[model samples]
Target: MRERFDVVPLAALFLGAASFLMPFAALKENRVVDGLLLNGFQLAGPLYGTVAVLTAFGVLTGVFLMKNGSRRRLLYAAAGVVCFWLTAALLVRAGMMLTGGAAPRVSPAIGFWGLPAASYVLIDHSKKGRWRMWILLVVMLLPAALLLAGGRGEAISVFREWSARKGRFFDELIVHIRLFGMAVISAAVLGIPLGILASRDKRIGEPVTAFVDAVQTIPSMALFGLLMAPLAALSRTFPLLRAMGIRGIGAAPALIALTLYALLPIVRNTVAGLASVPLSAIDAGLGLGMSQRQLFYRVEWPMALPHVLTGLRTASVQAVGNTAVAALIGAGGLGIMIFQGLGQAAPDLILLGVIPLILIAVAVDRSWGFMIRRWVSPGLDMKGLSA
Candidate 1:
């Protein structure tokens, strides 16, 4: 039987071409049209037309080389094109930044795969056992470099100017950090206990599971509103609680809302992980003269660690993204930029916020995923379980 060709690369190529052309057709002013086209070329120039054409040719050649076998060579060719484009884009961006050139017009197509390809290539090229450590070091150092190189100062100044009516950038950062921290901690505390209780008692499991499931049915914004009045009451009753007050608004309400949103996945995952432990393992532990505590701590918990970690990873990513909605309240976050941009009709500023939030979530998910795969699930290859 003849092998079928992979269509993904072809699709990506067509999509990229269309992305370049769409903006060209939309603009009316001659100078703006010319400028957009020029920008598109500069943006696409990193992966020159020649490179794309050659990559397509290489894919065709590989098909013949393999005699139409099931093996995948197109992935490599496509990856190569992506890497070349990304490297070029990064260098172009660096040059533009240094020389005070016109800002690179954003292309969603180019933006989507560029950095990811570059990062993947860098990691793939690094020596074994040290790749992750090096990646972390780069991540930590890049912001510092950008800061000292002027991006940080410029960002701070812009944010300060925009939020002058609100507060300092540091203040906004603190509020977001606190809200995120509270949501995470609260979810863990609530979820873990419920998970343990559910695992211990069959009667407790059904309703708790149902409740968490129902929580998911509630829209997040609606939940925020629902919690506002109760939280406000709690805040009013105790003067000491005033500092932690929800006020039916701001970070406190946002935190409560996010915590509620985060609870279900962690709780459900934890319950599933704990309950999935083999009965034979429990029997063996008991037969080995282990106490209940020992059986739980030494056997069951270790088996469940991967699952628990999986839940944490999921909850963390979800919290990071969902926290953006906290901007609807007074809790300031990167989402503030997104909302402000929407209000001002500036898509670039919206992307500025959204892009970083996505980067943060990806970074957290990948880092935690690596740790879970390498350490928590070492014996059984439970990386799939994390997924």
Candidate 2:
């Protein structure tokens, strides 16, 4: 069966070559020499036609190379790629029409559509080991090629223009980073100590946990307002702690608010993780002549790390989103863009802020989740780890 199937690639090659040549032949028949003369070597027509041919050839190649059981899978993937490109092309056409078809460059939808298909083909073909590196190399390089070919000067220019807004950009970024950092650090410093105390004594644990749970019950915006006065007062005493040199009403209040909100998850997770350590394990460590410090470092902490990391991940993502609310308090970040857009009724500007915030939250969550699943979690390998 493998020997019979080996002819498939050869057949695919012939079919692909025929499909490519046939399109050019059809184009040539339209006004023949005059059409060729008008296009100055018929460049643009052939370029577009070539992309269409290559796209089809990729699908055919993928079909021929896949095993019978996997052929359906490959076909589905090819269809998906084609659908993606078609939808993107349609959207681009729509956008062009909306803008009176006078945009400086091709629609971004083309790159968005084409790159994935090319990457899929490169990755699929490279699996045989012989061409794997070359396939990946092309996949990596194809974006730059497409970018150059598509003449993304306007896109680059827009970004360059935005880059000139460095003050607002950095101001927003720095404010958010500081707020998030303060939230995480304050939660860790305060929560870890409370976690240890709670683990040591139920009397302290119950009341503290109840208070944190109560705080958690409060809506975030309400809590932000509730804490602002107290935090604003504290900021008066600590001149160096103010964010952006705006003393009373900026990131200081936001940071304190986020920190208070972050504490419950961290402390609760820490307490639970520590408490989950078996009593027998602790007794065994003691019986083996382990010191209190030794037991905690060697056994308890290692066992608890996965849960702690989980809490941290949760807190980080929460802090990221919550920082947007801080914008209401003049703690400027991407939220500034969101509010600016809202005021101006510009969805694009709103997206500029909201999209990056979502991306940052997701990226941080995934990366930290991977770290915990891979290294921190006990008795699990990569294949079994939850995403």
Candidate 3:
């Protein structure tokens, strides 16, 4: 019989193995200039032979086993993960060795970045549920843990950058978090009521959603500019507001703009989720003689809750990304670092800001997923929420 194999994991493994031939990193004398590429052999140093052998063996063996329909898929995934971790470790070691006493910078290149993504595919394809989550977590953390323990490599470079501006980094990070947090909370508070009104009245819903959709079209920078004058006048007119740290140029306009940006998704999703509730459920609640308010609170809202949470999740991720743009107006978040990096042409500095933003977005999405799974009523089928 002809053998069959899983395509995705196999592709991921092949891609990862191919990355070994690409440049793993670059050594730079300064942030702005082009640096020299360090291939797998250079990156792995004394471990070059070991890394090369494993990359070839793992890819070949995994593909063969998968083709033969063996039950050892997880074993292949585990091996891929080990290869990935060792590759990262060696790259870090090389970076440290190069930058040990010199001021030269060691920044990760495409191969270094691509390897982890490919490894994630391997891990994800092989496992299910908490096992996948746990293994992924371990695979991700082990490289960092080893880097920290060794005190070397690109990890050291990022840490050095962090140390140089540690105070500013944390402060700006806090501001960035607060800005998006306030925006999302305000959007939810204002959005849910508007959503409820819209769900109950077509007249109200049409105008409200249209207004939100219109607001969403305005460029963030332009929105900030639009709010600047009005807020400035307000702050000047009301000394109390100025004293309360409500500034037109800084966080105030940024917050307002982001809040408006967050509204459309939340309100639309809320309306959609509520409207999607079963008519049979509504009639049954009425047949039981519940008041309109009682029926909504006890029935519709419970059923609509998951969809609403999904909306919140969408808004939150959007807000986190938009917060980066808010830094242009001096709102002071990771965007500040990002822009500074751009100005200086420092990729590592940019990563310092961007990596955290990506992580935050992922965390928000995962947390919401977990909550929906745990808190939403099992009787309600929410598979249609995105509809």
Candidate 4:
């Protein structure tokens, strides 16, 4: 019997190979003037041999996927991708080491960046279960851990930026976290009640959704600009609020904008989850002398929780991405590094911000997904939502 194989992962694997052969990073001086573009072949570090080995394994895994149809094969492919990812990081460190510690700026080029997408495609194609959560976490963290253990070259090069500002990097990182957390909390607080109200009353539902939907349509910068007038005026009118850090161009407006953007998903998911609850269950609860509150808390909330959680996951991811925009308004997140990089024409500085943002978003999205799979509903098909 001939086995049917998935073509996408196979294609991605070859693409990853093509990327590997290409220039992985550019060696620069002082993060401004580009020095030399270097491919993986140029820097033969201690792990250079391992990089070649993993690259071969990735190629073979793709071939295996093409010839065989099994979840096990896909898992192996994912493992290969993970190994390849670590290889790229080590390759960067190797390149830096080859530069002989001139404090060269190592800017990751196309190949270094593109590997993650290929890895993601491979992993997403694989059939996952509750047991795979640990594997997934390990896979996610392994690259960073290995890079750390691989050599000091990687750490020193990356942390050079951190060293420039002393403790400021940590301070900005905390600000980013606070911005994300506050927006999500506020959106949830408002969205859940609005969702419940909407579900309870069609009359109220249409307008509330329309308003949030409208809010969603406004561009981030425009929304930030729009908030400035009122917020600034309010700050001027109330010194107490101004003293409390409720400024127009800082965290306050940024938080408000992100919260508004977040409301739609949370509200939509809450309504969707609640609406998905079975009428029979509700009637049974009613028959059991359950009050309206009891009926919702007992029957509706539980069933709807999984969906609501899914929405929160979506909102949370969106919030992370959007918080970067908040940096434009002086809210001060990782986006500060990004914009400064752009202004200075420094790609390495840009990556310093972007890499962390991507990691944070992915971490939140995956953790929420894992929780949903484990605690919400093991049987729920997450593919549609994820896709």
Winner by TM-score = 3
Q: After superposition, how far is residue 188 of candidate 1 from its true place, in Å?
A: 1.1
Measured on C-alpha atoms, candidate 3 has an lDDT of: 0.79
Clashing pairs in 4: none
- Per-candidate Cα RMSD to the true structure, in Å, reads 6.3, 10.3, 2.9, 3.6
Q: Report every candidate's CA lDDT.
A: 0.63, 0.60, 0.79, 0.76
TM-score of each: 0.73, 0.64, 0.90, 0.85
Clashing pairs in 3: none
State which candidate has the highest lDDT: 3
lDDT of 3 by residue, 252-347 (tens): 899889999999989998998899888999999999999999999999999888888889989999999999999998888999989999998787
lDDT of 2 by residue, 148-226 (tens): 3342322221233244465786678777777887898999999888987898899999999998899889887787788
Clashes of each: 0, 0, 0, 0
**Which run of 10 residues does model 2 get worst, by summed lDDT?**
31-40
Ranked candidates (lDDT, high to low): 3, 4, 1, 2
Q: Supply the global lDDT for candidate 2.
A: 0.60
Off by over 4 Å in 2: 1-167, 233-246, 377-387
